[model samples]
Target: MTSTNDSNKAAPRKSGPSRRGAMKTIAGAAAALVAAPYIRPASAAPTALRALMWEAYAVRDVIGAFEEKHKVKFAPTFFDGNSEAYNKLRVGGTKDFDLVQADGFWPSLYFREKLIRDMDYAKIPGTANYFPAFKPDAFPLLKDETSGVFFGVPFCWGSYGITYNVGEVPVEKAKSLELLFSPDYSGRLATNARFEENIALAGIMVAHRMGTIDKPRPDGKSFNPYKLTDEELDGVEKLLIEQKPLLLTRYQDAATLEQLLVSGAIVAAPEFAQVYRLMLEKKAKGELDITVDHTLKPKEGGLGWVDTWLISSGVTDAEKADICHAFIDTMIKPETMVQIGKASGCSTTIDIRLLSSAEDQVLYLMNRTDELRGMYMFDQPSSTEKWERVWSRVQAA
Candidate 1:
C-alpha cells in the first residue's frame, strides 16, 4: 500500500514572486528562473513527454526503451497514491503531464469529473494482451459502463491481505482476519491507517461477524454492513473505540509496517504483496522470519485494487496521444511487465508465462484472479463513503 506523509502539505511556491511582492521581487524572479531552466511556462511542452506515476515504475532502462522506440524523451514524476496525484493535478491546475497512473477504482470517477480523457485503444496494440476480465470496461462494480471503454489500461493489480512475522505468530494461526482486532493479538497487530483501507477492512470484519453479504440496502442507496439500525452503528462505534488501545500503530505505508514487523514491534498486519515480499526477503537473509496468510477470514472476501495508465483529459495536444500510447505499449511488453511486477510487488494483467515461477504465484494470489471475477472490487460510491466514515471512527477512537 502507498502512503503520504502529510496530505495537507502546501504545494511548492512557483519560481516567481507572489503578486503582492512582484514589484520588489523582480530581481529575485530573474535569478530564480535562470537558476531553474527545467521549470517552464505552464502552456509550453518540454522536449520530452511528462508522466506521473507510482514510484519505481519508471526504471531508467524501461524509460530509455520507451524514448528510443517513440523517439521522444520523457520527464517522469512520482506520487504514492491516486488521491495525491489527482489533488496535485486538479488543485494545482498544472497540465504539463501527458499521462498519469491512477488507481483503477477512481478512473471512472475521474472520467466523469472530466479530469482524464478516453484512451484511443487502436494506438495501443498491447491492449489485446490484457486479461479479458481486466478490460477497462470489465470492472463489474463501476456505475458507468462507458467510463471503462479505454479510459485507462491496466498497469498492475493486487489484493490486500495479512502478513505476519513467523517468529511471533505461526502461519497457520495467523490466517484469520479476527486477529486484527483480537485482544490476544492486541499490541501486536498493525493496519493501514488510510481512510479507505482501514474502512474496507473494518467493514469486511464487521460483515463477517454479522454474517451478512454487505449489500447496499434494498433501495440501493447505502450499505447495511451490520444490518445496522443506526443504534447498532453506535455500538460498533463504541466497540471500535474500545479496541483502539490494542493496536501497535495505525500506519499508512506498507514499507513502514514492514519495518515494524521486521523489528518485532508488530507481529501481524493487514498488508499487500509488497509487504509479504519484503518479509520473504528478510527471512531469506536471516534478518527476520515472516509468512503471509492468503486465506484470511470472511471466506467470501479480501480487498483488490487495480492501477491503470490514463491520459489526462486536460491535455488537448494530439502529440500526447502518440506519446501516451508508446508509453503504454512499452509498459505492456512481457519483460517490462515482469520488471513492474518485481518492483511494485503486484501482478499485471499481461500474460503470466513471462514471470518467474515464484512471482507467478505471488501475482496469482495478489489478484485472486481465479477465485471469482468480481468478488472484491470496491467501486460503489455509497459503500466507499460508509467505509470512510467507519474507518475515520476507528482512527479517532
Candidate 2:
C-alpha cells in the first residue's frame, strides 16, 4: 500500500478524491438495503461517524449511500499499513475512532490488548451471505474461542505471489518462487520493499529446503512462515542477502512496480494482485503489448491477507454501535462487494455469489478455494523486534 502521506501518490478520481487515490462510487443502495436485515431507517442518526481504514474503504461510493440513508456523516482517515493504524489507535486510544480496519492477524492483537470490542455476529447479518471459507472456524484469530464472538469482519482479501510478464516468463516457470531468484531474471526482477513479506517469501523456500515447511508450530496450527526460529531467521537473512544484488530496485509503491513491469525493466517480482491489475489497466490503454499473469498457486504457496473491519472498544453508545454494524453489513453486501471489486481490481470480495461469471471467478481466482487453503495468511511474528533486526541487517548487507 502506498503511503497516504506521499505527494506522488496515485491521482484520485474526479468524482470523489480519496486520501490516496481515486474514490470510485459504489452503486446499488437499494440492493444493499434489501440484503441488509439489521439496518433500520433513522429519523435522526448520529451526525458523524469516524473511521480509520485503508484508503479504498473511505470512498464516497462505499459510504455515500449509507450516509444518505442514515443522515450521518462518514469521517475517515486512511493508513498505508496496518501497523500505522494500530499504533495510532494505541497512542490516540480507541475513543478517537468508532471503526477501524486491520489485516489478518492484527485483530488478534487488538483483541489481546482489548483495543477492539467483540461484536455480535447477529448485528451484521450480511455475513451469512459470505463464502463459507470466511466463517470463524476457518480464521479463528478473528473470533474468541470461549465466547464465540467476533472481533472483526473481513471485507477484502488477496494473495501476494510471483507476478510475471507472461510474454517473457513461461507459465511453468512463473508457478514457483524460484523464478524470482533465477540468474536469467536476476537484474530483471524486483521484490516488495516490506521486509516481513520478503522474510515470509524467503522463509517458505528455506523451510521447504529444510523439509519443515509443513511442520506445525507448538500450538498445533498451520506452520507459521513469519515466526521463524533463529536458524530459520539466519537462513532467511542469507537468502535475502543473496537476492539483494539481483534486482533493479526494491519497490515500496504499486506505481513504481507497475511502471517497471509495463516498461519491461523488470520481468517479474513478488507482488499483490492489485499491481497486476494496474498493469492490465495499462495494457488496456495500449501502454504495453505484453500479456501478464500472476502465480495463483506458487509451489511454496502464496502469502495472503484478509483486511477486516473492527469496531473500537470506545464506541459505547448503542446507537453509534448499531451504525458501525450497519456500515460493516453494507460493505459485505453482494452488490456492494461487486462494485468494490470492480473499482479496486485487486482485492477480492468475500462473497462468492457476486462472481456469477466463470471469467470473473477465474480472473480473480475466486473459485480456487483449495489453492487459498494452501496459502499462509499474514500474521505478526512471534518476535517482531527480532524480525526487524534481521530485516535491517539484510538491507544493510
Candidate 3:
C-alpha cells in the first residue's frame, strides 16, 4: 500500500573516509548498484480492482463513470456461463480476483464455502433500493446465515432465452423450445451448451407440457427445474439427445452464438439479450450484412438469471474491498443501471427511464410481476453431483 516514492531505503549513507577507503567503498558501491536492479524491483506495481463477470456487464461505456470516479483501473475478466465462473472460483480464482459478478444465486455456494466474504450493506447502499424490479425472495439469497451477514449484492436479472434471425423463424413459433428440436431447422439450429441451462430448457418443456413444474420429474416426484432430481434429469437428457442431430453448434458464450446467428449459419438458439445488440453492432459496422432481432421467452417460460456482485473472501486489502464496494454502489444507480439495461437486455434494480430502440422495460419485469410465475430463476440444485453426471451422459450422447 506504500507509495512508489518509498521504493527503497537501502541507499548508502554519506560518511568520511580515507582516500584508499573511499576508492574501495566507491568500487564496492558500484558493484552493489550493478546487481541491485536484478535483486530488487525499482517501484511497487500499480494495483487494479479486478472484476470477473459476464460480457456487456462490464462494458467500456457502462462502467466508464465509476472507473473515472474511483480513479482506479477496472480490470475485467469475463465468463460465458455461470458454470465456468464457479469452476474458476473453486480453482484458486478467488485468490486472484477481487470482484465477481456472477449468477444471482451462485453467491450462496460461495457464501457456504466461504469463497466470498460478507458484505457490509452499509458499504454498498445502492442495494438498499433493490426492489420494485427484483423479486421479494431474491434478497434472501444474499444471506447464508441467520446472523444476517450477507455475502453478495444483486446486479442484473435476465433470461437465457431464444433468439433467431427475423425471417428464418416467425415470431409466433419462436416462443417455444420446440423449435430447437423441430426437424425443419435441423442442422440450422443452435443452443447453449451449458449443462445446467440446456438440461433446464428440456425441463422447461416438460414443465410446460404437464402443467407440473413443482413436480418436474416424469415419475411424479417434486423437482425444481433449476435443481432437477435424478429422475427429472434423466427425462431432460433423453429429450436433449433426441434433439442433438438438429443442432448445428453447441456454444458456451454469446459472442460465438452471435457469430453463428449473424452469419445465418444457425437460425436460433438460447442466448442473452446482448447477442441481439451485438448483431446490430456488427451489421452497422459492416462486420455482418445480416440483421438478427427476435428474442423470445419460451411459451413455457425461459430460464431466468440474476447475476450478483460479490467481493472475494481472499480480498485481504481493506482498500481493495472498498474499491469493489464503490463499483457495486454504482451498479444499481439509475444512470449506470439504464446503461446496463441498454447494453444487456436484462432487468436492472433501478428503473431505467431512458429507452433505446434495442431496450425494453418489460425485459426487467419492472411492473410485470404477473409474468414471473412462468420464469425459472437460477439455483444450485441439492442433487448437483447427480445432475452433472447425467449431463455428461447427455453430452456424450
* Candidate 3 stretches greater than 4 Å from native: 1-47, 61-73, 128-131, 135-138, 207-212, 216-222, 277-296, 316-318, 354-373, 381-385
TM-score of each: 0.76, 0.84, 0.73
Candidates ranked, most accurate by TM-score first: 2, 1, 3
Q: Where does the lowest 10-residue lDDT sum fall in candidate 2?
A: 19-28
Give the per-residue lDDT digits (tens) of candidate 3, residues 1-397.
3654465555555586779898999999999998764353424332567778877777676577767777777788888767778888899988768888767467887878778887877887676566554533455667865767777777776677777887888877787788888899989998877777777788877655665665445546545577655555667878888888999888867668877886788998887666875566566678876666544467766777667889998776577778778788877777778777767756675545454233355434565533444566776655678778777887788
Measured by TM-score, the strongest candidate is 2
Tens digits of per-residue lDDT for model 1, 1-397: 1235353355565787688787658878888887785565655643677788887677778988777776788888888666678777787434667788877467776777777777787898876776666655565432347644557777777667777666667566666666677787788777776555555556566665665546555555544332344434544566566668778888868778877876778788777667777566566678755554344333536776777788877567676577777788888877888787777767677765645586556534534554435346534334445545765766665
Task: Identify the candidate with maximal lDDT.
Answer: 2
Error of 1 at 336 (Å): 0.3
Question: Which model is ahead, 2 or 3, in terms of TM-score?
Answer: 2
Return the TM-score for candidate 1, rounded to 2 decimals. 0.76
In model 1, which residue pairs have backbone atoms overlapping below 3 Å? 116-313, 117-313
Write the number of the candidate with greater lDDT, choosing between 1 and 3. 3
- Runs of candidate 2 with Cα error greater than 4 angstroms are 1-45, 136-139, 216-221, 281-287, 352-356
After TM-score superposition, the amount by which residue 190's alpha carbon in candidate 1 deviates from its true location, in angstroms, is 0.7
Model 2: lDDT of residue 145: 78
